[model samples]
Target: MPPSLKPHLNGWYRSLKATSRSGLRVERATNQPLAALRGALGVAIALFGALALSGPAMATSAALGAQMAGMATFQRSYRPRPWLALATALGLAVSTFVGYVASPWPALFLCVVALWSFGAGLAWVGGQTAGILASMTVAVMLVVVSLTESVSQAAQHAGVIAAGGVIQALLVLVWPVNRWGAHREALAEACASMADYARRLRHDPFAPFDPDPLMAAREAAVVTPGQARSRPAELTGVRPLVERMRPAMSALADPRVGAAEEGPERDRARELLAAAADILDMAAHTIRSGVSPKIPERAYAALALPDDGPILHGIARHTALRLIGLLAEVHDALETPPDDDSPRYLPRPGVRELLPLTVVAIRRNWTWRSAVLRHAVRVAVVVTLAEGIGMALPYGHGYWAAMTAMMVMRPDFSQTYSRGVARLAGTVVGVGVASAVMVAARPAPWVCGALAVVAVGGAYLTMRAGYMALSTLVTVYVVFLLSMDGLTLSRTAAERVGMTLLGGLLAFAAYAVWPTWQTVRLPHRLADQISAAGQYAAATLEAFASPGPVTRRAMRDALLDYRAARAALRAADDSAATEPVRHRGLRPSQLSDARAAVAAIGRTSMLIEAHAPTATAPSPGAAAFAGVVRDQLTIAAVAARTGTKVDLTPVRDAYQLWSDSADGTPDEILRDASILTEAVTGLEESLN
Candidate 1:
């Protein structure tokens, strides 16, 4: 083999292996019995209602609508469950109507499928829930519209489907199984993560922590004005304080910044961390249960500074003091009165307000350079081609092939390929199992309806248990639904399997031809992370120079931006790692070094943030140094993306100036400045 071909072959091998492994992996299912029961009840109600009013044919349509809407309720979104269900239902109804209208003309139907699939792909900009619901709408249209003959019949089917969605929405509103349940879980999980972090820091002061839980909590914070007014006191004013506690805890534990390793100060630090862990656990319980925290007496004692003066001195003492204060504030925040005037951080928009945002999101992804646009085009072409080919083939129910392609394809290579593999395996197993059940029992219509309901409920219960499980259960549900519509089990199973293979293979080929490889975007993502970290560092320094509420708020906002950027970069890197593509801009070593350097810069900023002074005294030359740092990093960010070396002369000069003018600066401020300078120097070396 040629040397050039080796990398490509290796990449393909790795990606294929990952795809197979990921397809087969089943995550542990989350125990949500009430939620599962609620979804099942919704399906049952829809099924029985349609059976009594119309026949099994209309009942199948209703069941599909209810099942899809119920799945929306399980998505990790802050939107109200009823609204999600309604949105999903509306999309399905519109798509079904369009599918039926276009079905008569093969060319026109292909065009309609292309347009709908494109829109579905573009919906990813709104987030995973929107994208999944939109794609499912396409699948629902393709499947449900096949039952109708005339325009009136199509409208009737669409109306019945919409009614099913309405029933699900109504059940969600009236049943109210766990109002604000997701929010509570997110906040509680974040607190518990902090507690765990604190405990870990006792042993490894620099323990790595994933900020995903806190990020989830922040997402959950977005609430409509009405929900904001009625929000639980425990949920408000607690998260911000919790965010501050992390840096403070880290600062106190670090030997370089706080207490000396293996000394009385270290021992004291461990005790305080243990106490903080207990306090955090209590706060998590309070948020989860909406009850007053039962503070441990030992935690209070551990937090109390000795009356004979503090055991730790300087920055370590200050950080410990800050951590203790934050802990107390969190406790108070948890115990806040229902009528407290604490400000809400994220106010969710109403439907009217969200329309413009949605439009803007779509417009942003309209450019040819956008991955979303590429994916949308890919989806349009692939689904249309699948439909065309399926129709050409000597087979019945050509829409199944189109539906398979719609469901399997994604913007990124990993997901599209993995889902294709999973869906194929899942469909085979699901169809086989369902076919066996049908052949053995030969159940009546009502019994088939019951089985469909059970399958849907099982799908809901195992949602977190991987895509393969979801596909399997959904396949079973579809099989049972079609069984009620008088389809021959053996023939249907064979056709279903064949069409799925056709669709899956078509999707895979389409992506191979026009792929959106994450590897190509790595440089841009890295640049973004670097820029965000620089801003965070600059903000932290500015806060040190001018300690005030405004500066502190800026620092907090910068911190959030930095975290988000880092998270995005990490996700991009992980996806790119499994993709069968060549590195485009940065070599592997350069990427690794750049990531390490950026991480170091973030850590330095975090250390400074830990000791953000309460006093309003300005540190000499600190502001100038911050400006230089920010400017240099901005240039470095550009350099990173453009594949050029960064020049750190300006930053080095500014650092020297700051160090020379440090006579009046606080000892801690000077120390942090030196660390920041070293981090910048490391970044320059890494980039070069």
Candidate 2:
């Protein structure tokens, strides 16, 4: 066997293993009983309302609308549920009407499918919720349009579907269940994460903490004007304080900067950390429950510090004092009265303002290098090909093949292949189970509708339990919904399974022909992260060199950008891990060391931020040193991406100049600069 062929075979083997593992794993079930019940209620109303008013045929359309809309509510988004339902319903109605109009001309309909699928793929720029709902529009078009014969019939079907979605949205408005639950949970989780981080730092001073919770909380904080006005007081000001506390705690515990590794100062730092963990836990509980926290006696005693002045001196003492003040601020913020009208820190863009942003986002992602664009092209090509092939086949439900292809394919190699396998397996099992039940029971049309409602409700409840479970239930729901039209159970099941297999295989083949391998993009992702981290570090140093509002704001903004870049790189790495391709620009060991080096840069920056100087005069040579660090890291980032070597001679010379000219600089600033210099050196070594 040729060596080239061996690598391809090995890649396929690894891909298969990853696909099996992810496709079959069941996630831990979250308790969302009220949310599940509310969604089920919407399905019930849509299903039974159409059955009573119209007939079994129209009931299918209404049920489809409610089920899709209901599924949107379960997405991990903070948007209002009513709006989500309305948007989904509107998309379904438009898609259904277009599909009906074009069905008479097969060639025209295929073109329409291609265009619609492309748009759906591009909708990912808006977010996961938008993308999934957009894709469902395509699926609804393929499935529901078959029931209509004429343009007027199509309008009626579309209206009823819109009404079903309206029913769900109306229920969300009138029969609200735990309003702002997602936001509260997100904020609470962020606080709880910090609490956990504080505890970890008690053991390991430099323990790494995942910033995902804080990122999620920030997402949750973006609310509409009305939501902002009504948001709980505790949730308003606590996040910023929580964000500041993390860096303060980290700096206070670092032996090189604050407390000695083994001394009375270290003991005091541990005590302070323990108290902080307790306070943060209390804060999380208060935010989540809207109740005042019960501070522990030990925590109170620890927070009191020493009555006869603090035991620690210099920066260590200052950091401890600052931490206590921030904690007090957090406590006061949580205790804010309900009538308090503090302005929101995050922007609250209404629908009218958001539309332009969405348009700009779509326009920006229209480039060839964008993953979304690539995915869109893949979808258009595969769906059109699948539709053409399905039409040529002996099966009656040709659209099922196209629908399967649309559902299984994603932008990334791992998800597309894994979901393809999972969808096929789930469809087979779902079809078989539903068929057995229908064959044995010989249920009436009403019974079929009832069973379909139950299946949809089960799907909603098990959404977090992995795609396989949800797919199985959704397939069962679809089968039962179709059965209401008196379709034969055995034939329907056989056709569904066969069409699903054809679609899955077509999708897999299409992706294999034109895949966007994440492994190849890892270097670019790492380069972006390194650049962002350098900017963040530079911003922090600038703030230290000249303490003012402008520099502070820049520091904050840079930190956020750094966090986002880091998250993106981590996602790329995870996706690359599941791919079968060989490493491209950076080898595994080089990538690992590079990540550690970047992390060190971020940690050092946080330490500087933790001890921001308040002197009126600028620190000598600090601004120049900041520029040097930024320039060096920028070069290193380019080297990472271009597979070139990074030189650190200029960086060493700049560090030496800064050190020699630090006669008037604060001792804390000098110490932090030294740490930053070492971090940059580490980065140079990792890159070269």
Candidate 3:
């Protein structure tokens, strides 16, 4: 082995020692993750039982209304919050009441929900869906069969479900886990290490940043607690897989990670992120085909940790597994080729990242004025139309339609259409199943229990995938649970189906009429990514031209800004939020045009220091500096396509001084380093 390579390779690995965030109190003492997940499961099951007993529409309505009320607010960024007293009453009402109606002051929620969505509304929606849907089919005993046959049953069911959810929230609170800095540190360390791999690929002049590793690394970097908008208390009860990553969130200070990355290694590292960028192009195709075989192994390979081989005990393993499972499901779908009418399930990628950072992410990524007004207007319009329709009809089912409309509205466009369809289908299926079971068996206590189990199972299934089929199942199960007590299974199913159809049609129609404009021009947006890469390359040149103090700070700030910008670009690329809007006005293709630009930038940055010319008390001038930067970028571009660039510059740093000159190495290197140092420090700000 070459002497330099050994330390180069081991350098990153050695930095994995667990470290504390010097001077932090209440240092996020977290309980075991599996324990918390199990506890949440238990609570979700208990609520499912209560909701199934809701016999009539009113009972289900009021309960659902109350639960919806609590759903509107949260206390923390992550889920599984301490149980709030409000949650109990809300759950009980929603689960037990059938035909129970609560007039939602649309104006209030319209504004609030719009903001909430801009915050953590999307993640909260998924969590609540999981939590509330699991509580389905139990209202037969909890509200419907046991109580007066009135619409109030809806409120009762909602109350019990909310209660259970609240309990689950409390469990998350005191059960012990660092909700703040320590946890963030751990996540940061993991990301930095992953970034190192990307940096390596970015700099390898010989090898273009392998899209596989870059894609994998970027995908891994998806979630940061900063993205979630809701209170931590509200987010705690939903997707539990993310909670596992909390421990490593505090390990951000590990300097070894993303540091050793240079030259070819740096190029490789950037490619890892680039691959993630390519997913946007591949996503629709992948989803439609239901096969993601294109996902490269490098994406998974670099993420494997030495501690337990990456996919073992850590949260990354679980997330990776989730990806594999999703791929398998997509593969199965393609192979089987299900009909449009048949059950279809697709994974909701990136929710784990969004779960905790919901609000901050929204504030950072989206235009607040547009998000609030667009969402609020859409929701309000949909509600008013539904109410108008109800008032015109003989029945008072307008409330149901109104409620469904509210539930389906969203600021995130990716799943909005899917949600509407799912709601419509599930309501039909669930109501039909409930009505059928009621007619056949009179929905005795045992039958109710059986249905309750089905709801829990359905909820569990839904948790696994965000596909419409699972949504259908949840819809069926919840309606069945509510109608169990009413003893009118078939009719209830039909009504739910109708109500869901009404809501789905209204929400989407409203959205289509006047939706929030896409954030940026797709072509320009994609092009900007290349521009950013260019800037990143230029910054690298500055770093190369500088000495210790200047280089360190320049590299640090440049990478920080670059990382944030790159992340936004990638999210637009791979996340469902951006892909479906492929309209004639803006063709959102895989940004191949900018691909070369970014690759050149990432790779050049990695190689600039390597290519910098060095001499004892060397000259300091624009010509010498430009030669290094110019040569590095050109070589980085060439190496990306041709394989690697030759770094022929002689090393004149202290390490070289000690070995070759045997004199005051640090002093000697510093004495001659002024030119490079000043060049880098002065020029570093151009990219920003």
Candidate 4:
């Protein structure tokens, strides 16, 4: 398992592992409470300002304050720029007004929804930051419209919503969280994780190979480069650096490389590995700090291997040299003028270009009919149904039902169902906690407001911890916001609980009506990943033979595509695993085999990528061998896609020929080629 997956896996593992035990233990109290504190402060300020500005319009102010506090959740995760923050807030205010304005008229409501849906689709297709802001805005609007009565009231709500956004914008300006900080941190963290992996591999060459850290680092690297729209050149090398490091790590960690009994040479190799880890740490630190460390001569000196030493020793020596090269690459990346010969820069698309692309996305999804469009339609219908159901109930808050549908209803079955369960449970517990506090001690409105602020912070802080914690905090925040508006406490808890349950049930029903089963998608996703892997492998091997500057961009893009497809396959399998046995698609073993093959391809591709750049004259047999491996990969990919039997004899024969011709091939190159051939051949066998 990749360490990246471990974070999620641990939660499930703990639950299953301790089913017969008494109960799970609390590890320790959290030390970093500043984020929570920041959240609370933002809300408190919004409330204070609302009260100061409009004394009589407390309800409007409460709504505005709540919106401001709610935005904290997004801030904590993304820390978007002030421009983006304001844009999202403005969208939120507009949606809230539209929801209210269209509430009394069904035709108007439909029109507004159609418009919102178009814009939402466009924004969703744009990127995560935009998608999140758009989704949250729509949710807020749905809730507002359902809750508010008249056009006048809706207008008031809109004004206050805008005011709240303005206040938050001011907060952003005053305490400007670095927008690109996460990008820097993610790349740094990836390097750090690689360092850790290297350290582990040094002590035990047979240590379980966990690519999760590297996967996460790659994900972060790709994302951060895109985020640097203003200066794409600065992050150009990040992708290549990660790509280069990945193969080196895999090559070094091969159990066969250093399989011999331990000795003084092994210890010396261990020292080199440890030193390589230090270089990785230095690279990570340099990326984050923008200050290059002086590379010591000892770092290179440590990698010296005696002639005709152990095979493992040679492997360690080669791996150490690669790491040293990577270290120098990192230094150049941080230099005043980068010294890299080839940099992987990404160009940001302008709005004009983006609009067309968005249209294309909508059209493609609409024609091919993907989960995105299905989910969009699902949200629209479910929210409407919840609204009508709420209006029918004697003590219903339509906003609650609509908001629940908006928040909980996902396109995928697993997430939709899981979110519904969590939302329902969290609401119940949160309402209960609020009721207990309010009934036991009837706190003043100001005190309730303060509690609301605190809850907002807690919610933001605990979001990643689990849905239950987040829900509890959010519920408290909402109840406190309502309390400030002089809402009756006697039925508040009951109404909240009932409405939440109703909303959850409705969202589930929406999906159940036209569910997008992961079972149906798993095979397709896996095939896509296989095809992408084939492209990447071909590009990498072709680079070795081309002799000119390889089209690194094509290989990089294919790698990204492969990564995305692989992630999707994993997600689909996870969803399917949680479903009833009857609904499962590929068996566990099949999925496992496919994943192993994909990973094996990645390793082989990396091997090719590592050695391709420095080729003078490709070995006489190397190009022919590469061609054979590439053809086998393509055939394997086709087999994976079409579910056909594979034949790899030709590839095997070619590898044998390459291995037999040992006249002029460098030992290191021969070793890498051997590794690549074995990986490719093994991958084909796995698929078969």
Judged by TM-score, which candidate is best?
2
Instruction: Report lDDT (CA) for all predictions.
Output: 0.88, 0.87, 0.40, 0.64
Worst 10 residues of 4 by lDDT: 19-28
- Give candidate 3's root-mean-square deviation (CA, Å): 18.9
- lDDT value, candidate 2, whole model: 0.87
Stretches of candidate 2 exceeding 4 Å from the true structure: none
Compute the lDDT of residue 362 as modeled in candidate 1. Answer: 89
Q: Could you tell me every candidate's TM-score relative to the true structure?
A: 0.96, 0.98, 0.49, 0.81
- 138-185: candidate 3 lDDT, tens digit per residue: 222222322343444434444554554555455444554443322233
Per-residue accuracy of model 2 over 524-556 as CA lDDT, tens digit each: 999998999889988988886788999999999
**What TM-score does model 1 achieve against the real structure?**
0.96
lDDT of 4 by residue, 57-170 (tens): 444344443454345435433334454546766777778887777767766775676457445634555455555566677667765665466778777767776666666667
Question: How well is each residue in 1-688 modelled by candidate 1, as lDDT tens digits?
Answer: 9999998899889998998789878899753878888999999998988998899888988898999999989988988889889989998999999999999998998899999999999989888878899999999998887788899988988998888889889988888877888899899999999999999999998887778899999999988777787777888888888888888888888898899898889988999999999999999898888887899999988988767767888788878888889999888888765455555658788878888999999899889878889999999998989889878887667788999999989889999989999999999999989999998999999999999999988999998898899899999999999889789887889889999999999999998888888898898999999999889999999997888999999998998999999898999999998898867678889889888888888888999898787676787587888898898999999998999987888987888887887457777777877887888888888878
Predictions ranked by TM-score, top down?
2, 1, 4, 3
Candidate with the greatest lDDT versus the true structure:
1
